[model samples]
Target: MDRQLAERLEIFERTGQVAPEICRFVRTELDVLDAAGSEITEESAGTLTSHLLLALQRSRDGGALTEFAADETVRAELAGHPDALEQAAALAERAESALDVVLPGQEVRFLALHLALLRQREAMR
Candidate 1:
């Protein structure tokens, strides 16, 4: 397994948890982003997977962090591409169902921020 993935698996095992299958869902999202022409890198995948797993754990632990007010920087970064936001929302929704917790807008926006950062990285490539 990839180093980051192995570390993630360790986190699950150490916590008395299984792989949760949500990783597959995240992989699908990454695939979708790639299909849409985003040049997602290995580093980005590792970062995103780690983040998503943590977010899922947070949801299960009843922590949504905070509420999100609209941010133009995020909007400006993702302008003309609502799909990025949608993708994040989809992941959050999936996490909610799998973890059985309510996720706030902040979590969704955090996911979108990750997507936006990936896109920015792609542009730099």
Candidate 2:
């Protein structure tokens, strides 16, 4: 396991809590992903986009989404909007690519898992 992920898991094990904002984001994203198992209408797409924007904001501010975490809803929305998908894919790919620089190879599996989840989410689209 990645050290960072391991540490995070430990922290959760010990504290039984994550940042409130992160928890909210994760729950919302996961619910959206679960909802993706059905049709992704325009209204759903708008909701997904709103959540992604929120996730992006959190990420930009150095907050982690380890608690709730983003899911496949992002990809589903992208499928609905090709242009937006392209933009989001680019941004996500960039983030994935930069993981090594960001973490210096410590617990890299955690990063891979994150990217994999994002890919799974995208695949839903």
How many clashing residue pairs appear in each of the predictions shown?
A: 0, 4
lDDT of 1 by residue, 62-94 (tens): 664565466555566666567668878887776
Top model by TM-score, which number? 1
Which runs of model 1 end up more than 4 angstroms from their true locations? 1-42, 67-81, 97-99
Q: What is the C-alpha lDDT of each candidate?
A: 0.65, 0.40
Residues 1-125 of candidate 2: C-alpha lDDT, one tens digit per residue: 22443344345335644344443343344445446463333332333333443444445456636442344554443444554344345445544454311221211222334334455555777
**RMSD per model, one decimal:** 4.0, 13.3
* Cα-based lDDT at residue 11, candidate 1: 71
TM-score for each predicted model, relative to the true structure: 0.62, 0.27
Ten residues in a row with the worst lDDT in model 2? 100-109
21: Cα error in model 1, Å: 4.2
